[model samples]
Target: MSRLVIAVFWLLHWLPLAVLAPLGQAFGLLLYVLVAPRRKVVLTNLRLCFPELSEGERRTLARRNFAITGRSMLERGLAWWAGPARLRAMVRIEGLERLNALKAAGRPVILLAPHFVGLDMAGTRLSMEGDFVSVYARQKDRVFDRWLYHGRSRFNDQLLLSRHDGVRATVKAMKAGRPFYYLPDLDYGRKESIFVPFFGVPAATITGLPRLARLAGAAVVPCVTRILPGGAGYVLELGGPWADYPSDDVEADTRRMNAWLEEVIRTMPEQYYWVHRRFKTRPEGEPRIY
Candidate 1:
């Protein structure tokens, strides 16, 4: 069934990306809404993250988030197959100049991009803005992993490092004065995290960004590309050149950075990619909400 789905995904993927962008997202949104188990995960995340919101608001957020996820998948298809230039028509982004400025500062700027919108294409565009390398994640199937790795790395010679080689590759590249982009969210089914205030709630988050930045004597920058309505492109918001990240207090830096990222996510709540169980990993005795 999974193989069949993947095969169908590949077959249908080529059509929308090549022809119609909005039509493509509509398909993805419908498909995900009808079939993905991740829907419940998104709803749970929304309710937990925004307790103060009324029930109707929570539902609205969930629907919006799902649409964003669909839009991201659609945009990625366009990015990989047809190229994401059309995606630029979807939303207006801010803070791009900040990235250019960071790159010129002589120190490699660590870009902390949240999973909101056209992150794939944004990474490529951001790379052109500066000397930046992004860590590529391993997808489920090895064949798919290789395929995705090549697609994302095609624009620039991004070192498609494996998870095991991530830190080594990043540190080496940073030493060479090249900036590295890494997603500091996601729970890898382990307790290797700190309870950080994300959306005013303690979301278990990876402290890798602050740790990596501190190691390279680099500055930490938060970037989020929001998915807008009507298949509008995206707005990539860049914030900060935070110094002394991941100080002696590991949890503090993690919390601070995560809070900043959460604010960025809040800017466009629906496109924030809430389907992933972000709080899957928790320390013993730490309250798990989702």
Candidate 2:
């Protein structure tokens, strides 16, 4: 089944953006209507994060978020199967100099990339520029796992280590001078997580970013990927490295990371990954939010 799905995606990779864009939106609308569970999750996340927006406004954003999510799903074909030249032509990157400067200075770098719909596109483009190591969750299906590993690692010098590899492995890679592509926003339960205010709500945020940066003596560079409307393509934005990150206070550093993420989401609320159960693991006595 996984092979067949990949085969279909590979075939769809040939479609021009003009055709795929609308098709993806239509499919997303259908999913919004049919996937009631995920739709509820999206709505729940939006409600929690954007209480200032009216219920109707949140609903509208939820629908558009699903649309972008679907488009990203279809566009993965481009990231996975398209030629480097083709992919490069579709991306407009900002702040390459920041990354280059870090590399030139031989500073260990960690890209604090949030969970955005265009994240894979950003990673694919960034891989072409320099080598980086990142942690990835494995798919349950073996065939899909193999496809994902190859698709992410096939271009440039990239290493997609399993999430189980933990901070030691990632820090080791970063200390070796390879940038770490870190996405530490999502909730992975309370084990190694600290409750940080994300959009003013206490969210179970990972402490890995500060821990890894401190361990590797890495500078934290913020990275964002925005999906262009009308299938125009994507923009990969890089911000300057944090001045005093991973300070003596790990929880404070985590809170700062979430604050930055909130600011970025305000710029493109619909593109944020709202379908995730971000607040799933609540405080011990708190009621469930989703």
Candidate 3:
């Protein structure tokens, strides 16, 4: 089944974005109706994150999210097999000079990427510009994993460190001039994660952002990717480096991270990855959220 899916992706890569995007969205709408379990997860997440929204409003948002999620999945073909010139034309980057300035000054940097639908597009586009390191979570399926790995690292000297590689290896890579593309928002269980108020709910967010930044003496820069509507393409926005981060208090820094993420998600709630069970790992005697 996986091989057949990959084959389909390859065949679909030849189609223009104008044609491909809507087809993907149509497929997404089908998934929203058929994939009841995942559809529930997306709705649950939206309810938790946006309680002020009416139930109808939340459902509307979830449907749009699933559509974009579908588009992202199908668009992996472009990231994996499209020509460099084609991808460069499709992904527009902003504020890259902030990253360049930090590197030019010999400062190790961390590109703090949130889990947006356009994440892979942003990473692949940046990989074309220079080398960078990111953590890779091995997928259970070998065939799909191989294709995902190849798609991500097919560009310039991209280094994908395994989740088990630990902090020392990642810090070393950062010090050696390879910016770390770090995604620190997901709920990675209780270990090394603190309960931070995300959307006014205690979310188990990993403390790696501040720890890694302090260990590698790297500047933390926000990297957000927006998926343009109507098959227009994507925009990867690189914000200026955060100042006075990783203070003496780790919990405080983690709270700051979550607060910043909440603000960003408000800008484009539909683009955020809401399908995941972000609040799965509850504290102590708390009941399971999923």
Candidate 4:
């Protein structure tokens, strides 16, 4: 199946360049709905995170999340061809000075961006505008992986690392003055994870954040990319370096960081990727809904 996905991408990659972006976007959204395994994961995550929501509310949020997920798949591809100058037009960026403050202080800025609306563009643009940064990611499939590499690094310097090398790569990048971007909210696996309070519930979170910051002296900055309804484009809001967070008690700080992330995500709950299996690896044998 993965090989077929690769073959399809290669076939399309050969098509006229003009059709790729939109075609990819359509493919992403359609796959989000039809992709059974990830679809179930997303649905479970949504139910666990937002139990207070009515069935109607859950359905609405799910629909919106899948749409954004699909669009993110496509928009990121367009970002490559869009170019920095043109992308700046598409995304009206603000709060750069805030990020620069950390750079000026000789502290690398570690952006704590949870998956929101326009993160693909947000991450891409930041590297273009600033000193360029590294971000944590699981290696993607070959066809898409090669495509994303060109697309993401088009105008920016993206030092992407695999999950295993996450700690070492981030530490080195920040120590050398490169700003780092990581998603602290998504659920990918159980290794190196510590359950932390998220949205008033304990969620398995990456424990490397505070330790990395303490080791490398990088400041954690929260960022969110929100695409407006009716296609008004996207807005990226940046939140600040949490002053004087402890080197120890990482679990506590991770919880606090995730709590802030949850708040940001909740403001636009419908846009959040709720279909993810955020609570997939719960501590107990059975998963609890919220």
- Maximum-TM-score candidate: 3
lDDT of 4 by residue, 1-290 (tens): 65575555445534433454445456656876687777666666776677898877876666667766666655554455565565675566667788887788787767877877578777777767755555544446766666567655666456767666757776887877787777767765577788777766667788767877787777887778887553455677777777886457887777777877777777887677665667766776755543
For model 3, how does the per-residue alpha-carbon lDDT over 1-290 read when each residue is reduced to its tens digit? 99999999999988999888998888888899999999999999988889999999999999999899899999998988999999989999999988999999999999999999989988999999899999998999999899899988998898999989999999999999999999999989889999989999999999999999899999999999999986799999999999999799999999999999999999999999898899999988999888
Clashes of 4: 2
lDDT-sorted candidate list, best first: 3, 2, 4, 1
| Candidate 3 accuracy as TM-score | 0.98
Per-residue lDDT tens digits for candidate 2, residues 1-290, read: 77888897898889987788777887788899999999999998888788899999999998999898988887778878888888888888999999999989989999989999989877888888878899878889998887777767877788888888777888889888889888889989999998889888889988988888888999999999999988688899999999988899999998888888999999999999888899998988999987
Over the full model, what C-alpha lDDT does candidate 2 score relative to the true structure?
A: 0.88
Off by over 4 Å in 4: 1-39, 136-140, 287-290
Where does candidate 2 stray beyond 4 Å? none
Cα lDDT of model 1 by residue, 101-164, tens digit: 8666767777787776568767655544445677776888876665567556656556555667
Task: In angstroms, give how far residue 274 of model 4 lies from its true place.
Answer: 2.4
Q: What would the TM-score be for candidate 2 when compared with the true structure?
A: 0.97
Local accuracy by lDDT, each model: 0.67, 0.88, 0.93, 0.68
TM-score winner between 1 and 3, please give it.
3
